[model samples]
Target: MSLDLTLCPDCGAPAEVEWRAVMESTDGPVEHARVRCLRGHWYLLPVASLAGPGCRLAQSPTSFRE
Candidate 1:
């Protein structure tokens, strides 16, 4: 399935969403999508609300420093 993206929150331009991966869990399946704006800004979408229509920003774990 394809992702339905809204207007970019960063540039107010149209954004495109591409499916990246899906994590299977006992609770259910979680879908992940990559969103990119026309200006080339990228963001990771963590869809905890899989069965619904919502998502949250996901920061890369590897980007953290101790």
Candidate 2:
């Protein structure tokens, strides 16, 4: 994983990534991260946004079931 930092939308605290994976979405495969902030706020964030410019989702051989 990249050494990128995500901020909590609610408290503006630094958020920690708990889990990350590419999931199937209506638009196609999208990378998402489960994150929690120092303030204990939890939320889901799109990996692409945190990945910086020119970031792309890698294709995963393993499929995920909802």
Candidate 3:
């Protein structure tokens, strides 16, 4: 299965790759996300699914927004 991470908002690099693994937010499960690039750079993204269109990171830091 292909990872659904977003592009880096700073470097335009696509995060969430295979083998490297994905992580969720620890800030309490936000609708958005923060992922790492191939170069190991981290960035913000929308919470997408690993199963389908609307999923989330398996186990990473999450932030809940109000």
Best by TM-score: 2
Please, what are the lDDT tens digits per residue for candidate 1 over residues 1-66?
A: 544554455765455565567867687887776777767887766644222333221222122222
Q: Which stretches of model 1 miss by more than 4 angstroms? A: 1-5, 24-28, 47-66
Per-residue error for 33 in candidate 1, Å, reads 0.4
Candidate 1 lDDT at 33 equals 65
Count the clashes in each prediction: 0, 0, 11
State each model's CA lDDT, in order.
Answer: 0.53, 0.61, 0.46
- Estimate candidate 2's alpha-carbon lDDT, on a 0 to 1 scale: 0.61
All candidates in order of TM-score, best leading: 2, 1, 3
Error of 3 at 64 (Å): 31
lDDT of 1: 0.53
Question: Which is superior by TM-score, 1 or 3?
Answer: 1
The RMSD of every model to the true structure, in order and in angstroms, is 12.2, 11.3, 11.8
Candidate 3 wrong stretches, greater than 4 Å:
17-29, 44-66
Model 3 per-residue lDDT tens digits across residues 2-47: 4545444456544563233245567555455556766788644444
